[model samples]
Target: MTMTDQRRKEEGTLASLFEAERQYAPVPSGDWMARMEALALEEQPAPRPAVPAAPAPRRRSGWREALRAFGGWPAVAGLAAACATGVWIGIASPETMTTLMSSDSSSLLSALDPASGFDYAMLGL
Candidate 1:
């Protein structure tokens, strides 16, 4: 078939279909608005009995419970070690720690310099 003929046939079919729909479509009465208003004003059926609210869940107390859950005995041991280290530093004379740290640092610096032979000049030191 030619393009024009096919196009004409399709258009005629669509036009007939729309005409059939218009003829059969239900037309609402003029009182549709009044009927709708009455439905809106009428008491609605009682709401289905409210389902009882579930009991609120109990909340766990914060940090302490979290720490216990996460680490248990291992966590306790780590805390004890930290506390002991703090106490040792607090009790020791400041001069003693300074001297020890200074010597250790010097030894480490010397070892790194001689063993690696790295030049500080490369770092713009």
Candidate 2:
């Protein structure tokens, strides 16, 4: 756009007015600055506390510890089966169980032990 001479003069006048206003701009007083600072602090969001990272998984104790002590799940299942059998026998009072319980322990050991006849000394370990 072509600027007329009048418009150029108006532009100069406007620039000078802006420069004068900038030069004569009032400095904020200390109280005003302090109040502004306080308002800024109020308006601005507070810094959030850092979120704690998720805690490490805790080691379990009690029943889980006892379960490990019993040689894990398979062993525990075997033990539970044995206990159930014992309870069943005690409650039912089976005839064969009574006979087995009454038999001599030495005779039972020899009967149950397949290695009874083997002479261990012959191995010369």
Candidate 3:
């Protein structure tokens, strides 16, 4: 067949298919469109009054403020000195520590034993 004849056949088939579709299609009701138009035109109701905002509570200045107000700079310095002394003693003294954390090095090695399932052997122990 010629190319012009093939093109004409395809156009005829497409037109028939479109006509069948139009024949089976449902027509739109006028009342549905009118109702939709009325709904679109209708105004929404006014919103309700908003609740009054709550007042913020006054905040306390806490321990630092108390230290500044009553204890003063000397008290603060004494507290800081005591804290430093406690830390120094904790690092230097062995007897003051717990038995598990004492100068006994074997306790740490035994705690890392593979028989206990921790497998320190895998780390070349």
lDDT of 3 by residue, 5-121 (tens): 776578886867766777899877999989888887786566789989888876757876788775898988888999999999878876534555754776655754446434555
For residues 8-41, could you state the per-residue lDDT of candidate 2 as single tens digits? 5677758667666878999999999999999999
lDDT (10s digit) by residue, model 1, range 1-125: 99867765788868677667778999888699789878887857766988999999887689768777869879888988999999988888677456656677655564546544346446544
**Per the 3 Å backbone cut-off, how many clashing residue pairs does candidate 3 have?**
0
Better-scoring candidate (TM-score), 2 or 3:
2
What is the clash count for each candidate, in the order shown?
A: 0, 0, 0
Best by lDDT: 2
Candidate 2's TM-score reads 0.32
Ranking by TM-score: 2, 1, 3
TM-score result, candidate 3: 0.24
By TM-score, the better pick of 1 and 2 is 2
- The residue pairs that clash in candidate 2, if any, are none
TM-score against native, each model: 0.27, 0.32, 0.24
Model 1 steric clash pairs:
none
Lowest summed lDDT over 10 consecutive residues: which window, candidate 1?
112-121
